[model samples]
Target chain A: MSVDIKKYLEEKQQLVDGYLEANLPPIGTPPTVLHESIRYSLLAGGKRIRPILTVAAAESIGPPPKALLPVACAFEFIHTYSLIHDDLPAMDNDDFRRGKPTNHKVYGDGMAILAGDGLQTMAFEWCSRVDLVNDIEPYVQVQIIAELAHGSGNQGMVGGQVLDIQAENTKVDFAEIQNIHAHKTGKLIRAAVRAGALLSGANLTQFDQLTAYAEDIGLAFQIADDVLNVTGTREELGKDANTDAERGKQTYPSFYGLKGAKKLAQECADRAISRLSSFDEKADPLRGIAQYIVSRRN
Target chain B: MSVDIKKYLEEKQQLVDGYLEANLPPIGTPPTVLHESIRYSLLAGGKRIRPILTVAAAESIGPPPKALLPVACAFEFIHTYSLIHDDLPAMDNDDFRRGKPTNHKVYGDGMAILAGDGLQTMAFEWCSRVDLVNDIEPYVQVQIIAELAHGSGNQGMVGGQVLDIQAENTKVDFAEIQNIHAHKTGKLIRAAVRAGALLSGANLTQFDQLTAYAEDIGLAFQIADDVLNVTGTREELGKDANTDAERGKQTYPSFYGLKGAKKLAQECADRAISRLSSFDEKADPLRGIAQYIVSRRN
Candidate 1:
């Protein structure tokens, strides 16, 4: 019953990468600096997890349209843009990200900010203008845009980031951790999964189950990140180890001890997989992803 | 031949302000600090030129739907978000905007960045989800979104800002000045007019003439801003004046002396009004606005 999660993930990752590189504005576009800056970070490298979830979730229900690839890449752009801005001097202020110089270090701060701004706006362009296929309902397209915006907006990732910054050195309870994680990373992840389901025309029951599955895995993913922050090496994580502690950011490891956090991660993965019993082998990739999120070394 | 430009601008400004206050996330939202920061800058007050242009442009074509109000406010959010980011310590580092403390000055740098980010995302949220009317073509809505995204994105406003920041302390030529102004402020203004015309289903000729009209006035508006920076008092400008030269930002006044710059503005205004000759009284407000942009002291 075990799925070849590694192979499944790799194939999806390549699909998303292909779509992104092919569809992104060419580097020679009039303002070469901006286009270069955007491609510099966007094409740099990452796990491409968010986009893979989109492509996979859509596949889980049925074969998705070609438009799904651009749609998936749009989420990746949002994630990448958030990372670029987060690493700015005014925020997390990190010099490095994913084993490379941060955007600001390479492009200068103003250009870095604009690159992030450009990428964010481009994401919306890709999301709403899926003119390649007319199958997606108009309101559904609007809903997808609204969902992405909500996940990225004040009450979601942005608010979570504000709270995360302000909560440095402040004691946070379990609820606070849940709230931050749910909003910061979880909402976008959930939206990614739900967006795919909706695009594939999932029924209400299937949508509900997938939503639950996404919530469980989203939490598990963040917990693994928190656990890795304490236990993983810098080379393995592609970022500083214990940097979370150094910055006084509250984490699952900080709230629950090492053993407790690990147990929670496993439990979340288990719960996530359990939510897919309604589907047959079609959901194997999503289930495998839930497990991999916790099992990954990084 | 003249309209009550002052009263027209005032009424439109009030419409946008009312929409913003009534629609923005309440201050009591869980992350009240972030919400307060957004409202603080959004409602703090300015001319609301961009949004008024949107509403006015729509009205010029036909009786706009209710969704026009939200769409109009979305531009205001975009404008306000840019201002908030522009005032950040890493950028212009201004302490005050519109005679009050800037976002970062009151909320700290992290909050200000998040507030800007939040508002930017919210702008997208508002741009989408216009479920109120079916008169707008689905593609038209997406086109509106794309236009807004293009205007605000890297190749547009954000790109202009990057150039403006980098050009500080550097000698700039006339072409460079036009490039910056055309992209920075002009594109969005053009989009406002274009968005309205498209929403109201303007013919190709109307669209073309209105686009030219928008371009002329948009450049004129920036030239007016340059002139004001050189001559207006701090009390009238609501922000620092003559600071453009101090920051080494090249301006129209800097390139073409004050008198020459004023003459250029008049030419732009004249060309803008000439484009509206095709329309009857329906376009009087736009005609008046074109005149007002240069005539305005602040």
Candidate 2:
């Protein structure tokens, strides 16, 4: 099962990588610094997890994975913007991300800031341009925009970021940590999955089931991140590790301890798999993704 | 004519102010700094020019100004976000905006970045919620989002910001400056006008004419800004003035000299008012706004 997950993610990542590279704004224009900053962070290697999930969800419907490339690319835009802003001097303040200097470190704070802004707007632009697809209805487009907004706005990632910042150097409870992670990481990940479902016109019942699966996997992914932060090395992670403990950031390991956090992550993965038990073999990728969330080294 | 323009702007400002204050997210539980950053920059005193234009454009058609409040508020969100990002350490590095500490200065760069991101997302959310208005058709809502997206995206403000950043410390031609100003400031201003017109169901002919007027005023506004940056005092501007030349920024005054820049502004304003002469009394506010663009002190 784990081997299948690796193969699946690798295949999907190639597709996502192609879409991302092709869709990014062309380089060499004025504000070249800002555009280059965005492209740098975007093209910097990651697992492409959100986009892969988007493709999987879309494929779970009758549509070909190729049909969902725009949405997959758009989700990456939102995700990349979050990372760029997250690593800013005032936020996480990390100098490096994914083994390279963070956007602000390389491009200066001003252009880095605008790069994030440009990327966020670009996500919506990509969605609007998807009107060329006959299967994607206008109302669905509106729904995707609304979901992306809510996931990224005050009530979601921004809210979680606030909690994260506030949680710094403070003793925080499990519930608050859960709430922060749920909004910060969970909402957008869930939205990515649901956006794929939306593109395929999933019924409400299927959406609810998928939402449950997404919620489980999303939390599991964060927990695994916490675990990796404590356990992985810089070479393996391709960036700073254990920086959470260094910064005293609220993490699963901080509250529950490493072993306990691992246990929680497994439980989440289990719940995520259980949610798709009713589905046919088509749900295998979803299950594989959930397992991948917990088992990956970085 | 100038007196009438002043009165119209003041009246529209009052309405826009009331709506903006009412729409601001309440300081609530969690008390995150990002929320405060957003509110601080948004509520900070300015002329409320963009929102006022939105309302004025709507009124130029048939309805009372109240009907356009959502669209007006949306413009304010975009404008406030731009200001917040512009004040970041990497950009202007300004400590103050609108006579107060900038958002990043008060809230820190990370939260300020998030505040801008949240506000940008909220703009579209506000547009989505315009479903409550019986007067706006669904197609018009789509059009409004499209215009806002285009005006705010890489092709618009973001693109202009990139160009402006690139032009910094580099010799740029007058056409390059015009292109930068058109995307950075003109597009949104024009969109604000077009959005209001579309919301009010203005005929295509009137929409096209109003757009032309908006484009002229928008360019005039930038030229005036360039002129003022050189000639105005910091005490009068409530923010840094002459900082453009100090930073080696490319501005109208930098290339054409102050006198030439002022003349260009006047020409742009003339074109703006010329587009409105075809309308009767309803266009008085628009005409006044064009004149005020070239004449205002700050």
Candidate 3:
């Protein structure tokens, strides 16, 4: 039987949310607002898709190790920080995310910026904390950190963001947009998959397959997001709809019609699932996640 | 004989500058402006004090290892990124830094912010690159990453910045200002020393002594800065002078007056040197650095 992806995602989301809340500095912590603002955005409840990918990827290789939890949470922290910064006045200028006022709107731009800065540093902090992940090899931990930083740094997410900003309101070709998405969103997603697999001691063959699987889903996820931005409502998506067109951003939908974009997304999902054919039932969540990426409403 | 700190600092700075120039993404790399903005702020002339401290501290314990350079450079990267973000319009709103237009002024606010973000991630990336620091044990590398992140994260620099922002144009007591400086500037400086010491395998006593030395010098460095802000010329200082008073920020001079602040700084420096009495002539650079803290004109 196919895995019940909804239940799987929910369970994983709860696991991530609980860990983040427990580990985060409490509300009464010094610099209360910075901590509060960080918690506000982080705990504001996105789909936790990135972290769950980390968890699901690890589970595919072995039983989800206890140490996998923090790394998963680290990805969530990085993703949340990126969203907080992207929502700032200097970036996308969005006022809301996930149906709530963005961090800058509530905390003011300065604190929001600090909140993002704090979260980014904390991601590395969590990864390097030996006490939390003592069972994992120090060497593996270094490799995980390298993966996270490389994926998130200039060559990756931030580079993509720069490209996105440059592309705004300008005539951009298909190749340019693909390059942007691959660097911007795909790198971190791939890193999340690799980190999880690395923590679980995936062999070379397993690792390569997972990397291929991650790339397919990463593209599918972005294309699906582009499609949803056009088709979904603000209330349904918990964010501004049709923002890509408004911002003059080039997307799959911009190049192809809605039907064509959806078709591409489905093909990516299919390829992602097919990459897992060698694995047993343990790989089902990975399979389900690929399907879910194209089908999710938000 | 005492170490000639001027020549020593010059040599270390050259080494750091060369390494950074070589390892950083070349100018023609994709996302060119982002890379340019990062290099603009980083390559701009500054004292290179933090990384020098890392190198000096490592030398105090043993010959500075090849692996120590990246960690040393990591501290500089962290320092540069903080300055860039601090100069943002939403934050300090500074028009200039180090006698040059701030990153936001030259590159626009969004790219400046992204550049800073890119630099911050690069710091961690450098720390974890096994290829560059293979001589260092993975466990020690994790420890260094932990130290850097802890000293730079919420409980450290970012938290300190929040405190500094909150104290701006407000009445704050000596204890409050001390707390702010300890968190804001002191923590990272201490981290620099500790990371250097760890890289060179300092014994517990050596580590503790270095920690004590770092604390005293950290306070001294801030107090000296406070004095210079009040007494130094804009040209000499290479940035806005008297900004603390203009902003009504509480500082050592605000509490102690110029004369008293200088006295306090000297006393702290003396104590810092005293902490290094147990070490041989190898630590002369550390002692000289303490003296330089209070004596430098800007």
Candidate 4:
């Protein structure tokens, strides 16, 4: 079953890859250091899951996946900016991310920081300028801005990050940990899904279902991350593994044991799929994505 | 003449100061490190020129200065965030800003970076929630976001910063330097003034005249900054003076002599005041602000 999930993800990843490469800020003549830093992290290899989910969600409601490329790229821009900033000397302070020296490590922190800021502003600029083909309403554009703003603002990702930083070296309860993960990671992921649905003019019923699916998978995704951090080897993960434990950071595997963490992830995967039952075959890609979240090794 | 300008600015500064202090994010109970970094930089003393201009511009058109407090506050948030980021290790690499240790110096690079990111998001969040009394139109809110996005985006301040970085130690011509300053610093100043006027529903005639005044003063403001960088004492300036020459950064005083720069600034002030001639006595505050820009010691 997991092998099938991998194959499906590969296909979706290819589609997302084409869209991302096409949408990136072009490497123009006399490209500045800031532009290079932005491109470096954006083009760095990843599963491209957030963008894929965006397109998949849009498809689940209405419209071809290609039409949503600008928004999908915007999601990638925000995700890449977060990763670049997170890897900076002041934050997670990681020297490497995704098997490469992080943006700050390669480009220096000043350009890296500006690159992140530029990408973030560019994300909204891209969304605002997207040609909606007369299908999406102007209010939908406003909605996208509002959703992205909330997902990225103090009450969402930034707040979650504050809690995460404060949680360092301290034991936080499961509820607190879950809340941190929900806002820190879950909000953007959920926003990606909803952005896609909203672009396609999703009705309230469909939005509610998609929201449930996104919330379940987002949590499951983080649980699997915790599981991988403890259980996977560096060679398999292509980056540091078990470093969280070494740093004394809280994780499900630390508090509940590896087996318990795996069980929780499986339950989340089940719940994620159940939320998609109301949709027709259009949601199969999302269902496949949820299963991939819990079962992947890397 | 200068005495009256100083007195008027002092009064405007007092009002802006009280409003900003009131708006500062409360020291969170058990304040997170990042929150502290944000508050520290936000409260550090400056002239409060940007917010005051916002209020004064609005008042010059139709309403009392108090009506634009929320928009004024939003402008301050954006200004403060830019200053924090500009002082970071990757950008200006300054040790002090406004007579205080720079945010990155005080809070470490990571927290300072997040603080800047948090403040930028907070600006928009503040705008979204502002109590629009005096029947400010909803479309005006949309226009504010659009104008702000343009001013802060690649075509505006960020673009100017990038150009400034590239021009460092290079023998750039006067026109290129002026373009950079106009975009980098002038755009936001102009936006601040225009935003105020737009909020008050100023007509096209008022818009044209106000924008011309803003453009003149924006450049005048930068010329004054260059003059201060070269001529002002460090203790009086709060931040380091002559740091531009020390860093091999381009400045009006560096290209044109200090005397020439001062002359240019005075001309800019003259032009700015002349643009407001069509207005009645109500525009006196704006004319005084232009004079203050040229004569300010810090």
Candidate 5:
């Protein structure tokens, strides 16, 4: 039976939100404005897809462990920090994100930078903290830290951002765009899934299968985003639509056209679902998420 | 017999520079610009005091492990990242650091921001990677990661920077300045020493003694910096003289007169050296560092 994907997402998002709220430094902490600024954007809402992938992937392996929450939330922190830094005046210069002013717009550039920096370090803090996730083997904790760093650092997300920025207003071929997407958004998404599997003690076959599933979905997710920029309304996208083209940024649609991009995205989702076919219905949420990723308006 | 402090520092600095050179992503990497920006600032020479402290602290306990280099370099990454971010136009807007154009001044603000982000994550990567430091126990690695995150994150370095920025051009009490120094710069310094001791397998007693020593020297180091800002020439400071007052930032010298600040620094150095009195001659470098912290012109 198909899962109620919407309800599952909402529930997972709530779980993650609760963890973040309970764990983050209180607003009244010394350096009040720093904590306040961190909360301001971090508490601001999004789909929570990155962290939800972590939870869903872990569930697919087995009943997810208690340690899953902190690891899951770590991905969210990384994602949130990237978003904050990305929207900075020095970077993407976006005024709004998810229907509110970006962190830099609200907190000024300096505090926004520090807020992003704070969140990034906080992610490692959450993952490495023995007190928070005592059930995790020390080796596993170190592995998770390594995974997060590899996915988020220069060779992955940061490097991808550099490619994306350089690609803007330049003639970029398919391979270049692919390189940008693979490293930029795709790696972290893959990391989220891999971390979940690693934490849940997946076997080699299961880890590889999940890795394949994640790769397909990560590409699908990015393609869907590219398509949305062209076809979706501002309200549906939560920010200005077609801004990719406005900025002369290359996307799947820039090469493939809207219909082709949508077709590619659906193909990716199908492949992703197929990769998880060996798993039983315990993975239904993951299957539904793949379907949802390609079809959702936002 | 006294240690040759000058020669010891030069040797340690060279060791750290060699590690950095051999390990960082080559300039020809795919995202060449990001790596270049990271190298531009990271390779720019400094005293490497933080890392040398780590090495010397490890030596004080016993033979330093292979893991010591990575853990030691991690502090420099944190330090250099702080410097890069501090030099951003949005923050301190510093034009130069250590006699050269700052990261933002050369790489532009966006890449400089990403470079800082890269180095920060790289610090975690260096700590977590089992390959780089295989001799270290996984739990010890995790502990080092936790220590670094604690020392550098909001409640420590980042939080201190926020306080420093807020305190600019404002009347501040002695307690406030003390708070700023303890968090902003002091915590990371302490973390450097603690990580060194932890990696070197220092006993609890040795760890406690070294931590006290680190704390004393950290405060002494900050006080010396304040006095230098006021008294040293631009050449000696490698930037500008009286820039602390130029920025309307308060310092130890601002509260206590220069003479009083110098006296306080010496007293801290004395306390720091006293804390290490129980250790044998192996800790001579650490002893020398404490004395050097208060006495150096820059």
Candidate 6:
């Protein structure tokens, strides 16, 4: 029987939330404010797409979902950290995310920065500990750390952020926009997939398939984000709409217009799904995620 | 023959600088500004104490000095990153460091934050690559990543920074002061020595000896810094003097008067040296560094 993608996504999201709560540092750790700030944003409602990708990718091979919990939590921690920093007054300066006050809005700016630093550091801590609980090979765990460091560090998301900030009010070219999107969002997503495959000890050929699938959906997700920025309401998106156009940030819609951007998103979803043709029932959720990315208004 | 302290220190510093320059991402990478900022601060002159500690520890335990260069470079990167972030207007608000304008003063606040972040991420990247070049076990590389993640994260330096910030102008107790010092400057220094021992595959007994030595010297180093902030001139320290007191930040001087703090610093150096009794002549540099910590005005 065909699966309910909505039900599947909901169940996976629930799994991630429960795992995170169980694994994250308790709320009353010595530095109460910093810990509170970390939990406030981490437990705050979001799609949990990155962590879900990790768990889903792992399950697609052979391991149970719970086995990948630490890694999943690590990915979420990094995503949450990036969000907190991006919303700082020095960056995008958004007051709300997903209908709730942003981290800095509630925690104060200094605490907010520390909270981000804490989260980023904790993510690495968790990644380093994966071998302690799981049966993954020691070398593979190191590989996972390398992949994460590569994806999130100066060469990847952080570097992409610098470029995005520099591109403000400039006439950014298509190549530049693609470069920014690939590093800023795409690399982490790719790393998530690659990590899941590594946990199951997948060979090079299989890993390549997952990588291709992640890259296509990653691009699609970015395009969808651009479209949503134009169409999403403040109540739904939990952020101010039209900020991209207002700030003249380079985006797919900026380069290709709304209609062209939507077409591109659909094409990306199609290609991403095709990349998983070799897999069986386990791949369905990943396919569902690609569709959901283009479909979600937020 | 007694080693020339100045010549020995200069030679080691030069080794670390050369390794760092070779390994760091070059300028003209897509985000030129961020790359330049990282290089500007990292390559700027300062005591390469942290990295040198790692290399020296490794040498004492019988590894070649250059073999530990990557791990040593990683230590310096984290230290440099911390300096960049601490000098942010939201944090310490300092304009000059090592006699040059702070990163934010040159790169702007947003870019300065990114540069710090980039360096931190690269530190992890280098840590993960240790097994690539050396004979350290994969599990040991994982351990090094854990040590770093632990030392630099919220529970370590970052957490200490939050506590330090919150303690401003408040009557902080001696225990609280010790906790701040332990996490702030102490953990990274401890981790540096531990990294070197790990590189050399030191047995548990030897590792404990190194750990004890690191902790004592770490505490002494913090006390010396407190003393320097009071007694050192701008030209000698290469940063503003009296700013710690001016900012109302708690320090050793706050708990113990200048004379008492100096006495405590000497005690720490003595204890640190005693911990090195088991090692032969190879441990001389570590001994010299301990004495230098208490004696140097800057």
Q: Taking the tens digit of each residue's C-alpha lDDT, what string does model 3 give over A147-260?
A: 999889999999999999999999989999899999899999999999999988999999999999999999999999999999999998898899988888888998998999
Candidate 2 lDDT, tens digit per residue, B1-298?
5337887788878877888777767676353576677878888778989888887788778774344787778888988899888888778788877888888778877778788998998887777663434655555666777778888977889888878888888888888888999999999999899988888888989999999999999999999998988888887787888899888888888778889989999999999989987777777788888889999999
Whole-model lDDT, model 4: 0.79
Weakest lDDT window of 10 consecutive positions for candidate 4 chain B: B129-138
DockQ ranking from best candidate downward = 3, 5, 6, 1, 2, 4
Please name the candidate that would achieve the greatest DockQ relative to the true structure.
3
* A116 Cα displacement, candidate 1 (Å): 1.5
Q: For the second chain of model 5, what is the TM-score against the true structure's chain B?
A: 0.98
Query: Taking the tens digit of each residue's C-alpha lDDT, what string does model 1 give over A38-108?
Result: 88888877889888888778888998766687778888888999999999988889887888889999988
All candidates: DockQ: 0.66, 0.50, 0.82, 0.35, 0.77, 0.70
Best candidate, lDDT-wise?
3
TM-score of chain A of each: 0.97, 0.95, 0.98, 0.94, 0.97, 0.96
Q: Can you write out model 3's per-residue Cα lDDT over B60-168, one digit (the tens) per residue? A: 9998668888899999999999999999989999988899999999998889889989999999999999785558888889999999999999999999999999989
Cα deviation of B215 in candidate 5 (Å)? 1.0
Tens digits of lDDT, candidate 6, B121-239: 88888888735644667787888888888888878888888888888899888899889889889889998999888888888998999999999999999999998999899999888
lDDT (0 to 1) per candidate: 0.85, 0.82, 0.92, 0.79, 0.90, 0.85
TM-score of each: 0.97, 0.93, 0.99, 0.88, 0.98, 0.97
Query: What interface root-mean-square deviation (Å) does model 5 yield?
Result: 1.2
Estimate, for each residue in A1-298, the C-alpha lDDT of model 6 and write its tens digit: 1557789879988988988888777878877888889999998887889888887777777764334778777888888888998998888889988788999899887788888888888888988883554466668778888888888888788988998999899997899899898989998899888888887777787799999999999999999999999989998898788899998788898789999999999999999999989888887888888899999978
Error of 4 at A41 (Å): 1.3
Per-candidate Cα RMSD to the true structure, in Å, reads 1.6, 2.6, 0.9, 3.6, 1.2, 1.6
Off by over 4 Å in 5: none
Candidate 2: list runs displaced more than 4 Å: A1-3, A64-67, A133-135, B1-3, B29-31, B64-67, B130-135
Off by over 4 Å in 1: A133-135, B133-135
Estimate the TM-score for candidate 3: 0.99
Q: Which regions in candidate 6 have their CA more than 4 angstroms from the true location?
A: A64-67, A130-134, B64-67, B130-134
TM-score-wise, the better of 5 and 6 is 5
Better model by lDDT: candidate 4 vs candidate 5: 5
Which candidate has the top score in TM-score? 3
